[model samples]
Target: MGASNFVQEMKEVGERLLLKLQRLPQAEPVEIVAFSAIILFTATVLLLLLIACSCCCSSCCGPAARGRKSQVQPMAPR
Candidate 1:
């Protein structure tokens, strides 16, 4: 008799748990939109960083860099 009562209690608890889970709301669309926005933002930031690095490196290390080099060089013998 006691064993049957325990089994019945467990079954009731399981049903309640399943009902709560079934009532939970889904968020697939929201998740997809958020993921896409994050990806786009990350890509834009990476592109901007790449462009900035290229501009700085080229202007500071290319032939044109020679123009600024003279300004920083120390004066030599007359």
Candidate 2:
């Protein structure tokens, strides 16, 4: 509530934060390399999946126009 009390509280909070930061374990050096490899692999897989879907859609759906003509011809002779 008072200015001194507020300043003391802030100082105590800052010290606690600094202590916690110092106590944290050091990160392993290989973590960045491993993370990069995982990201690259994921991007490659997503690109491959997009290409496959596009190929399948074009091959299977684009021929529907030709397929409808053939089906209609058989019914006309009947």
Candidate 3:
């Protein structure tokens, strides 16, 4: 089944990640620092982009600018 194939692929990916983690301890300090710096830089860039998008024109011109108004009105008794 397709699910079984997806599970097998996930297991393979997990194994590969585990092998990489096991090898991490043997890596040089400089390599670790460089990798850490790269990760932090990527995180910073992504966070800045997210903040910029949230603060842009969409918040001013989009549907969010309008207040919710009720559509129903009270009916008179017959």
Candidate 4:
């Protein structure tokens, strides 16, 4: 009997959630705009950071790009 009661309560809760989900498409417009803006801003910032890192690394590392010796040096064996 207790198990049956619990199952009925769970079914009622699930039904309520289903009703709410059905109305989800009518959410506030401002919320939709804000969410979209956040996504765009995050993507733009990540892309800019990646570009800056590549540029900085190429310049800081040895000139091995063409015909220059890298910063690495060979050690004399003792």
Indicate which candidate wins on TM-score: 1
- Tens digits of lDDT, candidate 4, 1-78: 999999999999889767755765786887667756866898999999999999988877747655565588899999
Q: What TM-score goes with each of the models?
A: 0.49, 0.45, 0.48, 0.45
Worst 10 residues of 1 by lDDT: 20-29
Error of 4 at 77 (Å): 34
Could you arrange the candidates by TM-score from highest to lowest?
1, 3, 2, 4
Better of 3 and 4 by TM-score: 3
lDDT tens digits, residues 1-78, model 3?
999999999999889867866877898998778867876998999999999887886776668776554689899999
The residue pairs in collision within model 2 are: none
What lDDT does candidate 3 reach at residue 23?
77
Winner on lDDT (3 vs 4):
3
- The C-alpha local distance difference test score for the whole of candidate 3 amounts to 0.82
> Taking the candidates one at a time, how many backbone clashes does each contain?
0, 0, 0, 0
Among all windows of ten consecutive residues in candidate 2, which has the lowest summed lDDT?
A: 69-78
- Higher-lDDT candidate of 1 and 4: 4
Candidate 1 yields a Cα-based lDDT of: 0.79
> Which residue pairs overlap in candidate 4's backbone?
none
Q: Give one digit per residue, the lDDT tens place, for model 1 in 1-78.
A: 999999999999889857744654454766657756866998999999999999999988888778664446777989
Error of 1 at 5 (Å): 51
